[model samples]
Target: MSGPGDVLDLIRERRAFTRGDVLEITGMSRMTVATRIDALLEAGLIIESGTEKVAAGRPSRRLEFNTGHAFVIAANVDTTHTTVALTDLAGRVAAEERIEVAVADGPDVTLNAIADRAKHLLADGRIGREDVAAIALSIPGPVDPDTDRPSQPPIMPGWDAYPIPDHLKAALDVPVLVSNDADAAALGEQRVAHPGSRALCFIKVSSGIGTGIVLGGKAYRGTDGGAGDIGHVKIAGHGDLLCQCGARGCLAAAASGRAVARALVDLGKPTASASDVGVYLADGDPDAARLTQAAGRVIGEVVATMVSLLNPSEVVLGGVLASPPLLAGVRETLYPRSLPRATRHLSISQSTLGEKATAVGLAAMVVEREYSASAVNAALARS
Candidate 1:
């Protein structure tokens, strides 16, 4: 019975393994291993794959976790849009949709819209409501990691201490988990792109500026889940500038994607949201590219300090400003401003996974939460 968790862990960690391998790794008798495998099979957590030929005796059946056993509902909400997706237990997205909505419209309106989109995505993926294991969400503000609720979010009006899990749970009828957008983005990048990195940092330059840190393959969310809120750090030169957090000369007020968009609009170009800046840059708009790079320079000034403090091996520039201009601006400042020893081996680049990063991270987190040792034990008891 105790071998179930061990067997599952081995299979998940190694991708595929045989019954004999699990027995050997767990040091459990053959009968106990067989019984544990049966229990996992009954719970639909794992499946037996084709047999592997041993060097000597009978062929052993290889076991792997059933990724399609259940579905996870994930949502990545930003200031101007929301992405909803249905993913398998392995964080593979089946179907996804992006809804144009505003985060400033209050959580009730935005969360309800997201719930409707999620239900439709589930149907599109051909997964039933009862098949949902959990729901996960990431927003463009600080979140209390312990409680999965918003925490005094400066830009998100009427969202402080909102019961995000309760609202989504009422609509979706499953456990809901929430985190800050930057944290989820970093975790996704770490899991998929740089799995072996010891220290990684993701700077999210969306409607605002924030950072997410991953140390040793885990998110380093500090006490009260406010570890990476770097947007409010004041800059010396921009004394008269006011930030959305009611602070003067804040980094976000000077260098965020939103700031760039506002600047473009003031320059007689039509720009609505931070995502619009990305669209314009992608279209090779010279003005957009130039201003975006300038903003990146301002952002890089702050990131250089972070590089000195953290000495992360990789720094991923993500969200709407993940472009050549941003990357170049960051490199321009980070290399010259940071300590030579700290940045000798540092690599900085744009986000590869794009908008799907948060959705995938949410699915991976929900799967991990649902299948931990204690959760597995409780599930077996219920079975």
Candidate 2:
């Protein structure tokens, strides 16, 4: 039987819809459509806009998804910094803050800091705790789907299987969701910038390299959540350079921002992390541009294989090192190596959302889960 949840699914997918449109689309009786719409309106899940003119009858009221009825708390945790945001159900940021908290500080300390900051953000926005629907976080590591914990992350020490969702849920008393940073950013880029692309790939060239895949408007987190851990893929002829995972000849060891930073430090540059390397690139440092471009070529060598396999419509470069030099370098190698058919529709570009991509994506993830049809139906049943 048609219910409020079913009607909502249709309305949310469209910009604005009318009862007639719903009837035609769902093939439901006028009474059923009216009843479901009325229920959704009463629940504040949807709102009536002005009106849409009809061919035969009087103008019908236009209905839209209510974006302001609830909010989400979203955060992105990197190696040396974290960003927290309060966003509406549509993933629009209301307020945000950045903190220099290290992920290496262990899950407890870092998560506590994030929780405190989140509370402050809510208080500042004058939003009540009950209004927050969920909390979502993106971390620079692989997360176990079943356990909702970091799964043997190479850079995040002491975070392996650390019960992240439970800790945050306990602190805030809200449902918590966790994601891989690259995966979240890929969703952000696809949802915000390339909504038409059915298949998209996002390569994050940060302290370490990672890949994110989005297929059919959904993130493709592989079984066990280890799908996009491309940084550990070995590159031939670099066995001398050891990776943080204790593996030699890894792609990240040879061509990631961390590797470029090490090279700069060896060349008497005062750079430490990938973020510092970004500053150097922004300053137009010749050495930084050169090394980053070279790194891009190396990364492209690996991405070429991904392009052939996935044949994504778009490939976005993100994270700290997503710049012109990197983009050019990837183009240099990716175009030649990938097959003509694979590269035909591919559009490679730098990130449009920049540092805020992960947070925005996390918010979208929360909204999609919390407001899904089954969830809405369950909530309506309880009400």
Candidate number of the best TM-score: 2
TM-score of 1: 0.91
Overall local distance difference test of candidate 2: 0.89
Q: How well is each residue in 269-344 modelled by candidate 1, as lDDT tens digits?
A: 9998888998999999999899889888888888999899999999999988889998998888778899999899
Model 2, residue 201: C-alpha shift (Å): 0.5
Put down candidate 2 lDDT per residue, 48-128, tens digits, no spaces: 999889898889999998989788888889888888888987778888888889998989889998899888987765788
Model 2, residue 280: distance off in Å is 1.7
> What local lDDT does model 2 show for residue 70?
88
Off by over 4 Å in 2: 52-60
